[model samples]
Target: MTDETQIMEINKPISKTVVAIKRIDYVDIAKGIGIVLVVMGHNDFALISPFAHKLIYSFHMPMFFFMSGMFFKPDLPFLMYARHRFNRVLKPFLFMILFIYFASISFSNVGIPQASRRLIKALYGNGHYLDWVQLWFLPHLFVVSLFAYFFFQAVYRRGLFPLRWVILSVLFIGGVLGITLFWPFEPDILGRGFTVFGLPFSLDLVFVSGFFSSWGMS
Candidate 1:
């Protein structure tokens, strides 16, 4: 072989090494800690004081979102990325909801009509409308992940990586204000007063969750 071919062969391993990603131990440790905090936040244990519970609630979710963003890869085509997320996040969400709803109708005291009504409402994916309230986070998370994907693509496309946090910060502030100040669009359902805020998968929270993810990316 010629010198150029020999040189290329010699450099192949080094190139591969440069692109290889090493496992981050600290990230795993942090994720473990975050999982514990999430469990703590969800339970009303006598061991956990009210203040501690509040503290856990305040940061645990943000921590998860941030970590998710840290690993965000926006290089994939939009449809491919969406399909991956749908399989990872949305599929499980639908499965759980369907399983629970059908189980209730088949084996529990819930009548078919009642279960059907709830199943329909569950499509809204809001916490208030859900029977398994905690599951509401999944759909919202899916939306946030997609939003982050689009957002980072825009930033990279425009060469605005440096200003990404600035843009996200502004959006975060606006989201906070909007959620706190404005009343949700409360539409009555089932002849009872049901307040639904974020329709079609908690879109209202996209900005806030996107900010946390973007922070992780930075």
Candidate 2:
């Protein structure tokens, strides 16, 4: 063998330390813009153009959902994972539900009727247990993340690396397209509305897109 071939073979087994430095200034800027849009949307400000509103709605919540998934590493034990998820997701969800209910009461005076309907649905186990308009995404995300966690665990146990990611991508994309195609084009039904298949113009599609995007980022 030549000298170069000898050297290459000798060095082939050593691991390389490759550090990746991310330039996330654009991400930060986008997040800032998203926060502004969210505030304006909530306050009924006319500053947001209709096109901007549509664009923001398309990706803002999805971006936030992907951000939420970024911190979830799978190295922890199952019990620890459960605890962490509960604290991070469930606790905040409960708090938001209560807070929004009160806010609706104070600001709109339609709280009692809305809350009553939500409570009835919760009791009957139909629709989401919580009915806060801006807060529905939280519960949806929590559930989706939990499902993803378990799915990751199962794939990890099987010693699949890149193949698992491929499977996840296919499922996520297929789900998004399927839901978007079949989604109902109507407003949610009172108290009984639930759409896991991207009803009301592909809401779950965006969330699933965010979930898949999170995995792609890592």
Candidate 3:
């Protein structure tokens, strides 16, 4: 190889590192702020005024989804990207939720039958059903990130990035409508009157969170 080509090769990795550092710098700051807000929001019931608590809760979670989108790349194939996400997001979610659930069974007064029922509900991945409610964000984020990948891939592959905002807006609106229309349909399982809400894995919130993620991408 030419000396010039060697020099280019040496600089490429350095340049990439610098670019990545620059890209995530502000994102890191925003994420730090959001983290503090999330903690405060969770514990602020009597520590802060009602309006202050409301303000903190308003955007903390959406901010995370938005930041997650900022890291999206539409270049990877579907399975590869999905596997990567499974390892990074879903795996951690499963590990932590299981850890908490088992800890409750081992130490707390939770009985085996009750624990079994809770485990079943936890499969739904909805916060309301989990022992640790705050963990609901992980599975929800995992789904949103995957949805964003497909949505962006479709747009990018079709050379429709120019119209991405319009497409995203339509999809987001449809998602909202679907959620609204289905809000009342709590289907009973086995005619036992047990109902599931928001769908498994929080799939229903995809478009809602997608809007924030799209903003991050833009």
Q: Could you estimate the TM-score for every candidate?
A: 0.82, 0.59, 0.81
**How far does residue 189 in candidate 3 sit from its true spot (Å)?**
5.2
lDDT scores in order = 0.84, 0.61, 0.80
* Candidates by TM-score, descending order: 1, 3, 2
lDDT of 1 by residue, 118-138 (tens): 998898887867898888878
Which ten contiguous residues of candidate 3 have the minimum total lDDT? 13-22
Model 3 ranges with Cα > 4 A deviation: 1-23, 45-47, 182-184, 188-193
At residue 74, give the lDDT of candidate 3. 71
For 44-150, candidate 2 gives per-residue lDDT tens digits of: 44464776667767766666666656656677887787777778766786676566666777888676887767644432211234354565555555555665577
Q: How many clashes in each candidate?
A: 0, 0, 0
